[model samples]
Target: MASRKSGKPASAKPAQPTAPKYLDAKRGVANWTQATEWLRVRGIEDIECITPDFAGVARGKMMPSSKFTSNTSLSLPSAVFRHTISGEYPEETGDFRYDPLDGDLKLVPDLSTLSVVPWETDPTAQVICDMVTTKGEPVSYTPRNVLKKVVELYTARGWKPVVAPEIEFYLVAQHEDPDYPLKPPRGRSGRTITGGQSYSIAGVNEFDELVDDIYDFSDKQGLEIDTLIHEEGPAQLEINLRHGDPVELADQVFMFKRTIREAALKHGMYATFMAKPMQQYAGSAMHIHQSVVDAKSGKNVFSKADGEPSEAFFHFIGGMQHYVPRALVMMAPYVNSYRRLTPDMACPVNNAWGYDNRTTAFRVPHSEPVARRVENRLPSSDANSYLALAASLACGYLGMVNGLVPSDPAYKTVNEGSVDLPRGLLEALSLLEGEPAFAEMFGQEFINTYVGVKRGEFETFMQVISPWEREFLLLNV
Candidate 1:
């Protein structure tokens, strides 16, 4: 049976990487015509076709409206988001499959999903779309479609997942030498430095000017940015955004990355959300905070009096703990991502939960009802926000239905024991492959296709040699 956790005998600490502006609760009118008017008024020349990338990001360039995008819907190659240009889904009879060799797919905006891109000239606006064929059903396995399906699941149950994101990244000088590899940051004069002061404002003086633009731009875009904080890596910063429904929250994350990257470029610097950019620094993560709310009453399903989450919260936490191993492949998509979960990287290496504990993979923050929720602290900033969120909802649903019960968390790091993430991408793939239960959970077709793409990616990575290789093996060989 699940039981309420007792307070640990320690001083209460504010949640790390805290950003309050993100927590300000408000909603916007999603009228497409209104947005279009906003764009036209700004003299936007043309909308380049808006299409979803393989990574679920909206990508395309723009021209004059008279020249392009004036047709309302543009054609894209369906092979774009598919794992390979070959367009195979695990190969029929173990052989690969390809699509209609012709690159003739359509991109029709949802209109309601349009949001202004702050940095773009002529004020180009982007709207996400649902990929379809001659018939109009959402694509069965598009990652965004997968997230939409999960959102429907919650809606059916009269519940919705409220979500917020905490994204961490590093700002660095662009490298000219591909042979040298990007060297990690050192605390140069006026450079941001890393210490464990997760939320100390003084730590942010290095980017005194840059952080201001991030704040101002987010404000103009009506982004629910809470605050930006100095993280535990020299030159790394974590920006927190306010919580909202799952899909919108993920959308905010997508936009948030764009904002930061654009702002960094304007200042002539580079920003990386790479999971483990440096072995010595804390790896970047796009941590998600979530809770369930009743659709009818608009009340928190996880809430108890004083904003404390209910017993259901424990079950949800338990479900996540159980599913971490199987879900790691999706959360940590890249082969190098596993490297970030090692000791001292800030991400928990294992499936575990704790109350008000930063060391645990899941943290229960010290907040009352509106703020009472669990923090999923594993995924790298490079994660496709939609897919990771779907994975999270699936796990939370598993916890709720199976009645998962969490146990006391380990306050300290566990390195020698099993309290760690899978050692390698291959191992994570095995966890996914070995689990028929999870395949059934996510649907076999989806699982099969996704695994095929990930495994293919690993095979591709294995073919490349690294600078670290020449350093150790050149003279030795």
Candidate 2:
């Protein structure tokens, strides 16, 4: 399965580092022509030029293959960058970026991301695009570009970062009512999960059909899924992707979520990446395993020659501890996201590091020198992969460049002595705004827009009354 992910279209891989003339608009239209021919041979008639928004939702335009091949550029409203999670425009804020007068932004398709839509009957290909102004500057808030900037920072230092993401989600029976609690979907064995079964083979076999189909679709889409394990939650499951380049890994994570959801809908069940879908069960997380390697030698830089830890490794951990609180907005991006970050939720509530200690936010796994890595348990499954990876890598990069030292490992447990992270969305957002390192790393323009948009989401969430409130406070108040 891991080998399948490296099968890229011939166009994606080049002997040289720089993009070829075929991709440049000024050079020639040959690449577009070649791409059109390539799709035509594969029975694809349409192309969707997609860009991930601030909320990590796919947004873009669909065009016929002929138009896509002929057009030199695609135009989408710049306001799409500022749209909130509810699909609402933050017009009330009056920020120039959110104003109604927003105009067009150019969409540059990343030809390398082109993949066939296995779920669509008519044969469509989708490629992720990068948003840029007509003058050619990358849009500050574009999630992919934001990630690319961080990757570039590593490239400049002759280093490469590899990441593997473990994503957890739930399979539930679809319910139409907004107030109703979700129930586990019945498996092919005619039974709904009633007990916690962490790593139970019988538990995984209950939904064997669904699990088989997920693997089938994942392979069809070139996702390099490595392992599947039944989690402690009733119907919750976790999938692990093999470690690879950060940007490529993020793309796979993004596509894998969509594929899982669509496959679930087809089977009359629903899959949610919600951080805390069930009140009684453990929350879901997108735990990331990261390691830095020397670009030239292709060797792990976190380990020394005699198998001792490297200075870079300690600095990386220090950076993560120093910066994770400020990057919480991207790690746990929604109101429900904070619900998963409680003290005993098996979620990391602080920046403490430990050697194989699940209680800490960052854990140094036991591995060979060549495979030494740090596992970040901070991000929820609901996070935008691009932003989350970018923020995580940026923190480690800062630590490496500045030579910061990490605090002593939490050899005991989280209960002994660990600092608590922000307790809620509002608090996390406030922390993000107050952190100077984050503002300087991500830029003020992005910070302001992201805060404004997410603040609106938080405000909108407060307007809705929940069943818990009514049940507990309606008569008492």
Candidate 3:
């Protein structure tokens, strides 16, 4: 695809964007009154009343600003939660059966998530909604709701968990056909990027205009980006988000994916969050750096007063090492996701933990005690942000509460083809189904539906005959 040139003059300076005023207005809008006033002041014309589905796809309705009020009620079919990535309902949904007469679920707006849709031509605002029953009970299976439930577990224990996500993605040429492989887009130098450009400034500068748009869009939405760097894959870039509350960060990530894709389309390219978009390049990952703190004292629970590693820290690691494989289905949700977990692809092959080791699934980075945290390198970039964060935190919570002990730190590289994780989606789903802990932490109904959705996707994949099958088996067999 050809890149579209912007009409702005080369010497012109871009205007400095300001954060949304509602953010500083008593931390955020607390009620519909405050939310209405904020929208009114912005001269908003349309409101996107939306919620993230299981695939992190924004699903909801758009209403005129005048019709949007504090009392506005929006509903979607409960079947939306049971939808596979292909938008089809699974034939079998485990113990949680889908009702023949699809029911409606209410969408309750979260006022804090209200932000301007900068990419839209019309004055539009979007807000993330939480799904609830007509009786006002939360929909436990919804991804955002699942994360909130896990966070509440920490809150009940007087502990607050914080997470920062480093998400990697690739910019590829626009291709209309699904059968063809993706190719890197042409940059400013009129050349396609080659692999092995990690941390290269010139590599980043090649797509300066698109990168600037990403930053501008993020600023308008109040998404704070800690840093952006080139990764080891061709045209692959990683954006690190500032750490904060789990739910808040997850919301930002869900929104950020939309923002990034829109910005890329504006430049005539496609930004793919696929775990392994290219066959011969590095796979993308969403590496999560997480830690816990005392809710009252605001002290780091992973570190003691003397700046030494706390028992809770080790337990958290132990929990991740023990339970991440069971929860792998949540992090690597798609069949293609497992292709990214192979050794020597800049991906972790085992659940081993070590100090600043990239080969291990869990790594304790070098930091002062206050910033001490464990980095989980298992999740693929294609995962649902809310579910990934919830699964990770739940595992750590189980470790801390159960006083689990981790194996000794891995002193040597653990990625030498010693695969410790399930090799396929079905295998991972089987592991998840056998683990009662996940069902206990995240409701059993959710577990059933999630497993069912994944199984349906895997079955659909099996129906397809790949080029490889025809290339060899067609003649040889």
Give the best candidate by lDDT.
Answer: 3
Query: Which of the two candidates, 1 or 3, achieves a greater TM-score against the reference?
Result: 3
Give the range where candidate 2 is weakest over 10 consecutive residues by summed lDDT: 21-30
The lDDT of each candidate is 0.69, 0.84, 0.91
For model 3 the TM-score comes to 0.94
For TM-score, the strongest prediction is 3
Candidate 1: lDDT of 350? 67
TM-score of every model? 0.84, 0.91, 0.94
Candidate 1 local distance difference test against the native:
0.69
Better of 1 and 2 by lDDT: 2
What tens-digit string does per-residue lDDT give for candidate 1 at 1-477? 323464554555567984333222122324544444445555656554454454656655455645443455556665566564234333332222336574555655655455555677655655566666646656656676677777887787788888888889888767776555445343324444555656667767666667778877676656777878888776789988888878777767776788888888887777888888776767898888888888888777788766656888888888888886778777888876877877655667767777777777788787777667888888888788888888878788778878988776656654334646677877887787677656545666566666667767777777779878988999998
Model 1 residue runs over 4 Å out of place are: 1-36, 48-51, 60-71, 83-96, 100-103, 181-200, 304-309, 411-419, 437-443, 474-477
Candidate 2, which segments miss by more than 4 Å at Cα? Answer: 1-33, 91-96, 415-419
